[model samples]
Target chain A: MPFTMTAAALKIDHLGKRFGATAAVDDLSLEIAPGEIFGLLGPNGAGKSTTINMITGVTRPQTGSVSVFGYDNRRQALIARRLVGVMHQEIVIDHFFTVRQAIRIHVGYYGLPDDPGWRATLIERLGLGPHLAKPLRELSGGMKRRFMIAKAMIHKPRLLILDEPTAGVDIELRRSLWEFVREINGQGTTVLLTTHYLEEAEKMCGRIAIMNRGRLVALEGKETLLNRLGGRRLIVTLAQPLATLPAALAEDRSLLSWDPDHLTFAVAGPGAVGERLRRLALGGLHIADLDMRKPDLEEVFLQLTGNGNHHPAAEP
Target chain B: MTGPLPLPPFQPWLPFLTLLKREVLRFLRVSFQTLLAPVITASLYLFVFGATLGQRISVLEGFSYAQFVIPGLILMGIINNSFANTSTSLFMSRYLGNIVDLLVAPITAPQLILAYTLAAMLRGMLVGAVITLIALGFAPLPWVYPGLGLVMALLSSFLFAQFGLIAAIHANTFDALSMFTNFLLLPLIYFGGVFYPVSILPPFWEGLSRCNPLFYLIDGFRFALLGSGDNPFWLSFGISAAMAGGLFLWAALLIATGYRLRN
Candidate 1:
């Protein structure tokens, strides 16, 4: 088969995977364009990892087809795999080899000769210079993740796939890592990332696909996704406790919450924020402190997945 | 800052060689377990079996008992090491999930299989050579056809390595791998007449030994080393080569299907 460069770096069509009786990935399809960062956002067991496995040739989907850079993944796996690089969800490494040695071995697997120049560039890019000589066993959780990203980039693949790359990383490290990812994408490397950090997706991905129960429930631009979830919020905290909602504000009760001294409400849209404040003042509820939380990715994600459970901590 | 950089030129064989080197280095890094231990074990077998059995049985057609068993001992070492290397490497990679790195690479299944099996064969040959050298301490080992012995050893090593890879793919746990080694490999090697000729067995058992592929491998190596094999040299060579070919094809098929490598 001949090779051609195209606008879409990856095109997954009607992909589905079944493990005996359970369907792990169901009828998933998406198109990732070159130079674009795409996010696969979903909860655990939502088939995010399974979809990645299919795209990278680590696992075959029982039904449907995947094409990478115009090469069919199942039919031209070698070529497809050549164009893609994957950083798996698990932080697995050969404990025996130092970071430099591991990077060398990974580069070799792609049949690329060791280039000290390229290694140095990656070391600087991923902030791994200090840990170059350290074995994987000796590295901290965040450092190990950085090393994995560096390893994936060793071959300079056209398409990069990251499955939960920041699972155990700290906040500062994640910010820097996302910056590096942005730098790579700026250089025209297509990135397909699966992350639990909804904010990361909103910041990095041009397009996001939300998966749930082995199904692709939502796929759209970040702004469009948030718009679909409706509007922002206006939170009010009072100095005195309130036993019940004032009768005049009864119509907004579904969108409002009341505690002894704290009151919160979901503002329906831009116009609703003004009306909500006017009604609040009319009810004579004196606010001690008021905060308006913007409609962030977390709210959008919760509305789409229909689960209000907050992540214990934001993933790095 | 501007446009995307073009990918560097592709070098097809470079990755295969690198993976092969990694496999070799992995086994060599633990030479005490992969090489020296096998050699010592073979030597002990030679000392005990050759010394005790030679007193009862006359030298088998011009070769001493110690000399007669050397080929079988080397072949045995080759089989064990080859199988062990491939199976353990693959199983460990799978268990640790590092195999995903190989699977996602641009490398083909055939290249992956060849790199791994070739590494296993190299280790098997190294172990076999060490055992042959160790056997020299007990008695002077002669090779009627040094070239033929080398060829037989290599072919047998490749065969066993392929078998071990296939077993690794099918196995889910370490116990499954161990079961095949202990219940199948050990029995087949011993019953295939490594120490004694199959002609001394009951007619029924002798017929069964002919069916064991390892028997043909040992017979071919023994023919090259002693020139007094139980079967004709051509017959042993033909059977062993055919067995190797079948295993190679099966391994290729398994990898192509992405059998256990896929979810």
Candidate 2:
């Protein structure tokens, strides 16, 4: 986060876009550090894809600017574009080409040469080697996703933006895909990702930005946000079923759940749990087993978005 | 694949060249529909109108009707295929959502237009060449003003290819695209003096035919191939060149600005 004199790898400055009176991305500004894995999380219609589209020059920003490395995405568009590679949300497979031919041809789209060694490395790395001579459209869904990854990395881009890379994929592909993403980040390629799976973001991202209805709701380091927004929960199981006479404990607003068997409260610090326990004993409540639960990314995401039946991307 | 390779030298035109190659390969992959279909259609016209009908009527001086219609058939093939290639290529890319490949490319607008147009022209000319060979079997035709013939072919192909680019940009559905070919394009080709001499028509129809744009292309090509046409070579060539130049500017503007191609 200390991107002082060194330029940010991807800098979005008050970027805004509107579609027919709807603000798809409203006055959003965020910076990504070089060699960092950044996560953008939101619910459906939260403008994640619009933001990526602006960054990749697929859509122009209405109010603000985007820059990749040191080049403005609009003014120095060709240069800025060369530095960023994108794997679109959709598969977008071309039926006219073989997998090898499409990957080799796509390299030139970024004005890069066809380095056979680098090309082979990418094909093998993405597990696309055996399907090289097959038509691109003939590949199965998982294989097509792998082919897309190879295409996105064919130019050896400095920054890679993946819009929902693991959506609808099986568990094995998702695990290998995340591992490959981490491997690429380790090799100095800055990555910006938006995914539906919150647990994946928790494990992969160093910094996370949460958006809601086209605005930034939270931006912090992974652990900091987890602690600040996803505070710990303390659950206490009662020795006996209580019949509705816990006014003193119920009045505390941090208390989340109470049942015949248990009482739960949201606790910010370790001290809060012990203090609550002493108060419970003083109130003549029988002693019971106590359990502590650490909040995961899913809790924070649910609280921020208020709904999660779908995902957050391609709203614009 | 064990060790990373050093980056290769950058070629500025690599993207343009690759796109051009892709566009050409697209039609060639379906050679039956693109090349053989047009050739077969042209030969049918030759056989029906010229071989069977030629024994009765002669349209031009010292040249049989078969020889006269040959040039027109070739020009029509060049025009239709040129338009078909680019329009289908661009529209299919949009329909399948793969146009994002071109949208994200580092190449410029002119490079994009030239690549598509040139590839379309190659297909158009290939179809024209096959039709020409088929025409040769029907009649002994003189290759009059061969250099002029090539120039006229290039200009006609360039004009139609650009028009196809514009059509693709504006077409929202396959129905809209088919309307262009059925209602507008075929009628113009039919009225443009493809099957018969414009001179044989009534004065009013002949005068109206002069106003049709395809008339100039066919007339100019006829002058080049058979040394006889309704209009002189310079007049037809000049009009075709001017139209191509104007269309180029329009196509270049639309492509550079991503008019209907991007949001």
Candidate 3:
């Protein structure tokens, strides 16, 4: 089938995978266009990694097919693989080799002839010049992630697949790395990324697909997905502890919470905040502080995943 | 209007060569452990067995017992080194998560199998040659047919290398690979009549030894070295070649399917 956009980078059709008795990836389909940064947001075991593996030809799907830039992944695996580059979630490097040597070896595998200029440019672009001579074991977790990105981009592939690229990276480093990725995407390379940080996906990706229990639960534009969890929240800090909810605030009781020292209530619809304040004022309750909160990707993710437990420690 | 295609078709060999080069460089960088250690160990076996026990036995035909065990020592090195090289390399790649890099690359499965197997073969030959040279230091045996010996050594190395790759793919842990080597490969090498001629065994035991592929490999090399073997050289060569071909096809198929490499 012809894609909505002429330059389709990847197309996965009705893909399914099972590991013994457990279903790892269900009958899922997705499409990525050239020059687009598509985000795959999901909790652990959501089949995000499985999907990437299927697309990269690392794992064969039990049922269905995948195509890279229109080439069938199974029939024309070599052609498909050549067009795609992947940076895996785990940090893997040869501890003995220097960064320069490691990249050189990787570049050699793709059979690129010695191009000093391109190598130098990559080193500088990735901020790896200072660590070129340092052994991989000496580099921190963030540096290794960046090194993986540079290694994946060495062949100048048309599509780049990054699985949890910023899992342990610091905030500043993550932003800079995203900026670098944006620069690469601007040059027309399609990027498919899976991340746990919902904010990162909301900021970087125009389109997103959320996988849950090996199934695609939601797939749409970032805004469209966020809109699924309607309305906003208003958290009000009270001047004094309130013993009980006043009669005027009974209608919005579901959204209201009696904080030990601060009163926080969620507003379900537009202009509910004003009405809540009016009710509180009429009840003679004084507000010490008021804060407005919008529905971000995290809320939408929790709503869709349906597991209110937001424990980051459980993530892989 | 449609525009012409901007980029030319990419060359396929680039990724294959890249993987091959990496495999070669990995083993080559650690020649002391991978190359020299095997050579020294094989020589020790030759010295203790060929010099001590060989002297007690009467010379077979015109050749001495020391000369008789040379081919066995060399073949033993080929079998062990070839298996170790591929298995260790693949196991490390899997454990370190670098295999994903190759999995995601544009190279075909057959190419990957060939490249990895060839690197193992190179290591096998290097170790085998060192053992041969060490054997010569004790007893100088002329190669009855240098061409035949070279071909047999390479075929044996290729077969064992493919076996190693298969074992590595199936193995979930390093201990699993070690179990196969210690339990299967080690016993087979010792029982393959590498130390003594298979003629002295009981009828059933001798018959059983013939079933071991390593026997054909060692016997074929012995024939090439001393112009004498327990079985006809051509029969041994045919069996080894067929086994190697079958294993190569199986390895290629496993890699093509992504087997255990995929999640």
Q: How high is the TM-score of chain B in model 2?
A: 0.94
> Residue by residue across B1-263, what tens digits does model 1's lDDT show?
22222445778987898888889988887889988899889878987866777445644777777777878999999999999999999988888878888888877778899999999999999888888877777777567888888889999999999999988998999999999899999999998878888877889999999998788889889989887888988888899899899988998898888788876
Any residue pairs clashing in model 1, and if so which?
A: A111-B15
Is 2 or 3 the stronger prediction by TM-score?
A: 2
Fnat of candidates, each listed = 0.63, 0.52, 0.47
For residue B101, model 1's alpha carbon misses the true position, in angstroms, by 0.7
The per-model lDDT (C-alpha) reads 0.82, 0.84, 0.81
* Chain B TM-score, all predictions listed: 0.94, 0.94, 0.94
What lDDT does candidate 2 reach at residue A239? 94
Write the number of the candidate with greater TM-score, choosing between 1 and 3: 1
Model 1 residue runs over 4 Å out of place are A1-5, A253-258, A268-271, A281-284, A309-316, B1-7, B50-59
Compose the digit string of candidate 2's lDDT tens values, residues A31-65.
Answer: 88878999999998899999998898888788999
Local error of candidate 3 at residue B246 (angstroms): 2.0
Query: Between prediction 1 and prediction 2, which has the larger DockQ?
Result: 1
Residue pair clashes in candidate 3: A82-B106, A109-B18
Best by lDDT: 2
